[model samples]
Target: MRADAKKNYSHILAVAREVVTEHGADASMRDIARRADVGLATLLRHFPTREALFEALLCTNLDALTQTADELETSNSPDEALVSWFQEWLVFAQSYRGVVAMMAAAHTNPDSALYAACAEVHSASARLLLRAQALGSARADMNGDDLFALMTALGWAVDQPSFAPRADRLFQIVASAILTNPSSKDIKNATR
Candidate 1:
């Protein structure tokens, strides 16, 4: 791609991501083009279909998240690292309210690149969960699958507009439940 073409493509993707995140997956490509200050032809060149654009955006975010998980896995306390990662993860989830639906749809499509990206995130999450278990921070019986389900459910629950105000509290409660050591004093102190 030429320099200007690459720049236009990048801008379209960035704007499309924001629009889709805010207005939902059904957001229009023409609107994205306008937001990006590009033409319809440019948008179509970058993403031929809405599904393609969504998959691209979703994969990009998941890739970044997986990288963050890798970094956290190397932290001194695997338990704290996992918890901290969840805090960040919840924030991301809240920001991209439709992401869970996109991930689910992608996972259901075996041929989609999003499926592969989802698998990578799942693998990275499992590693983080295992490390937390090794550190004696998580319950011995709590497997990676369990943690994954819990996190997904919690993310969806907290993503609701009605639940927005209590999202942080909800996350803290979930984290406290998962963590081996639960202390209200600690949570209070941390909040302060």
Candidate 2:
């Protein structure tokens, strides 16, 4: 793609992501185009339909989470890295409340991009889980699918308006459940 075309595509995706996250999957592509300062033709050239755009947006977020997980692997302890990655993932999930729904739809659609995006998330999360388990910080039996399910449950909680206030607490509770010995309290007191 040309420089300007690439710039336009990036801008459209960014704006579309922001709009969809705030307004939901039903958010208008025309509005996104206007926000991106791109024409309808340009937007369509990049994303032919609403579902296509939504999938691209979902992929972008998943890609970012994967990159962050990769970076966290080197910078933090295995347990801390897992916790940090979950925190970031939950935040992204909460921001895009419709993601769970989209993923479910993707599962049945066969042609949906969300399926591939979800697989990417799964692969990245599995790496983190395995690393934590290898370091004896995470439960030995916990697998990638289990972690993914836990995340989905937490995301559902985060999506609820009533549960939103307790989202952070919920994350801590889930983290505490997965960690091996030396509970969060013990680890915190030890550090102090």
Candidate 3:
């Protein structure tokens, strides 16, 4: 890419990040272009679709989360690691407004732009869940896809103002349900 073109791409991505943070997954491309002081055509040239733009924007964070999951597996006990990663994943799911739907869709669609990133998250989640289940702490009936769906539902609740206040409580409830034998210390450590 030429210097000017690269500069424009970076600027557009930065502005899109800001816009998405404020307005969420449905944020308008035109508005992002306006905010970046770039033409709509320029924005479209760099990101042909909304999913592509979000995939680029969230790639770093998703990779970091997956890496964190890897580290937590070795550093924490099975239950604690699973719960800790769950909390982190939940926070990431709620980072941008209305992104849960995109994640949910991408999770099942191989052709989606966000599919690879979401799949990585799903795989990491499965590993943690499996680790916990191996220790008899987590429920054996559940899998990564179930956890992903739960996260999506919780993320949806967070998008609604009224339900936002209950998200934490709901999280605890869900966590408790996932863990078959959560000790007081485990719960305390996980929730923190």
On lDDT, the leading prediction is 3
Stretches of candidate 2 exceeding 4 Å from the true structure: 1-11, 28-45, 104-110, 185-192
Please give, for residues 1-192, the per-residue lDDT of candidate 1 as tens digits.
999878877777788878977787668889998888888887887888776787678766777888888888886467666676676667667777666666656655777656787677667777887887887877778877677677777778877789878876887788788878865554433332
Model 2 poorest ten-residue lDDT run: 183-192
TM-scores, each model vs. reference: 0.81, 0.77, 0.95
Candidate closest to the true structure, highest TM-score: 3
lDDT score, candidate 1 = 0.74
- Model 3 bad stretches (over 4 Å): none
lDDT (10s digit) by residue, model 2, range 1-192: 999878878888889878887787768888998988889888888998777887887776778998999998889888877888887788788777667666645644667757777777777788999999998999999999899888888887778899988887787788888788636764343222
Tell me the spans in candidate 1 whose CA falls farther than 4 Å from its real position. Answer: 37-42, 58-60, 183-192
All candidates in order of lDDT, best leading: 3, 2, 1
Residue 187 in model 2: shift from native, Å? 9.1
Query: How accurate locally is residue 48 in candidate 1, as Cα lDDT from 0 to 100?
Result: 85
- The candidate, 1 or 2, that scores higher on lDDT is 2
